[model samples]
Target: MFAKTLSASHQHGKRLSEPRIRQLGSLVTWLCLSFCSERLEICDFWNPFRNFVNLEHLELFADWGRPRKLVPFSAPEYGLTQLRTLKLRGYLPMEFVQWLLNEPAHVEELQLCVLDFPGIHCGGHGEPEQFFEAIPPHMRDQVVMDAIEDRRRLRGLARFADYQDKAIAPRSLACLSFDTIRRFKKLNKLYLYKPAAGRDHDDLEVYFSVSSEFRILLEWRDLILATRNTLEYIIFDQRPVCDLRESDDQAEIVCEVSHGDSYKRFVDIVLPTLIQGETFPALRMIRLFGFEPYEDDPCKEGPQEFELLGESENVPALLQAAFPEAKITNHIGRPIFIHKKWGELYGGGDVLNDTAGLLTIGEMIMY
Candidate 1:
């Protein structure tokens, strides 16, 4: 009872004794594991974790040895029934995340970095029958399978993957998969990491196509619609859709979401269109990083080099109807302009410093 939190780092290339793990699982309320090497088997912790009945916060991060495949959690119910916050980094398998959400872990806040989703393969893009079947019947009508037609038109494009050419479906579903979240009745805060476009300044327009971007947008809409009764806050980290404009004198990045792969477009166009004037009464706040904050007084600020979209005054009717009472904050400039990865990871450099102080790797807090 005295040791309420435990943080362990495996750097010496030795397997942690199973007895010690089982012992600590019963004693610790917070558990953080940092595996420094790939030699330690990760599967060893699955059963031991069942003993962590008091654990409310679980953080697992590693620089290497992300699991290739995760066997189902053998128990009928998860030991982490009281889990409130779960953070997983290092490219966790989507199936594992699906399994956790499907079970009885009523996590309120989830932060995942570089989760494994299917790429443009046979199942998601070429033959999407399985993907469609996975969607719950109640929500199935909302999803529109337009990736097929889009891939058909751009068959000859050298950059795009020819999903039609693939012989069989990949092991994982390629489409935006959020059906499991329907089981999470109390989930309120979701934090996800998405790579920004236009990292290479030379090729500005080679990112996601309009159709692909729209599909992702629809997925977000469905997620909100499903959880509209309880979910309140949502934050998207490292999300950027911008272009690099270069001239003889200078070069700079400008953020745009009119028809591109940006969250701004999701708020401005997609949500408004899909909601059809419906309002998310429970939704209170939405935050997006890698974009400038909405400035109320345009005259107060001087001429800017980079163009930023999603001004509050531009489209009031759609914005007002869709969110109605929520506060939307778009902060930080385009991802390409940001210097530190943490700045993009959090909202800005200042917020990054603040977050680091509060949530370190091994620090513990008593609720």
Candidate 2:
């Protein structure tokens, strides 16, 4: 045997028996399962794969088209100690995320697409509500008293302290406890795929407040701060803020925050906080997709090619100054310059193929 890599995708109705999986455990060093469907019974069979102690890289992709219940797989007495990278896609259970963060694999590179935040309230929610039962009796009582006293605040070291012992579905994206995130002590490279635009955003808006998106950015800021000492490379994949257009004489940069006024508030009010405390010495690179050069006018686009815009011009500058030691690039990995004046010389899309190396949400899931 001794296979170096084993890859499978879109196995809609396939099943591998326990003995077969155990056989492959001794053979394969890397495994990828993609587009797993409801018929796969992943949660029920996940533990068997833990026997693959030599597995170094594991990639799992679930069918996002069909939302299914993902139960937490019980933690094994031993872990895949040699595993170094874990990539997951589609809906993942909160408890499962907790199990992973509990140092089961000690992965250094982690990629996630979407995390399912189950509703905490009991009753008909399509799935069984055993999340509350996962908490210990003592913690359950304390959680109730804290809720009664309105002491479940999202700040300081006490942030997410209640959720530390057990997992509870956060009501909103902003409320996702950091205790689960802070456990990624060995995380060095993180690639967080932003929920795609259109249907995804629309669904999120219906489920959560529009402001929750902006608030999640604040949450991400704190996440970065918490992991600043170890995290080296991070990428936030998102949609472009503006479309770059050019005519013969001049270029037009049209920018808009599609999520509306809250994102602007986040930019004005919260982003500066990223630079307030100690510098992130370990951060080597930060790539933010969707947000590029700052544009003054959103409505009309034209050759105001050389105009002087005031405080707004320093927007990109602030991000640059914040991470003095890191190289900040756009989606195409081209270095973004801090604009001193409004219509200063733009980088002019240095990469010939602007979309090169850019991975769409679909591409990310498939690959």
Q: What digit string (tens of lDDT, one per residue) describes model 1 on residues 1-367?
A: 1111221323224445556756866777787764332343333334345557667777765332324333344443644567778776543344444544454337777765432222332222453565455443543343354344335534534344643332111111113355555656776766544443433334323323333343444455556566666766765554443332334111223234321335444454345542475555566666555433445423226776545433533333444356757766554433322222111122222322222112232221110
Which lDDT values do the candidates have, in the order given? Answer: 0.44, 0.44
Clashing pairs in 1: none
Q: Write the per-residue lDDT of candidate 2 for residues 133-181, one digit (tens) a residue.
A: 5333443454344343222322222245443322222122233355656
Instruction: Candidate 1: list runs displaced more than 4 Å.
Output: 1-13, 32-54, 61-79, 117-125, 130-179, 203-219, 241-259, 263-270, 273-279, 291-293, 296-301, 304-321, 333-367
Query: Which residue segments of model 2 deviate by more than 4 Å?
Result: 1-20, 36-48, 65-72, 104-106, 117-180, 196-219, 239-255, 258-273, 292-315, 331-367
Candidate 1 clash total? Answer: 0
TM-score of model 1 (CA atoms): 0.57
Clashes of each: 0, 0
Tell me each candidate's TM-score: 0.57, 0.54
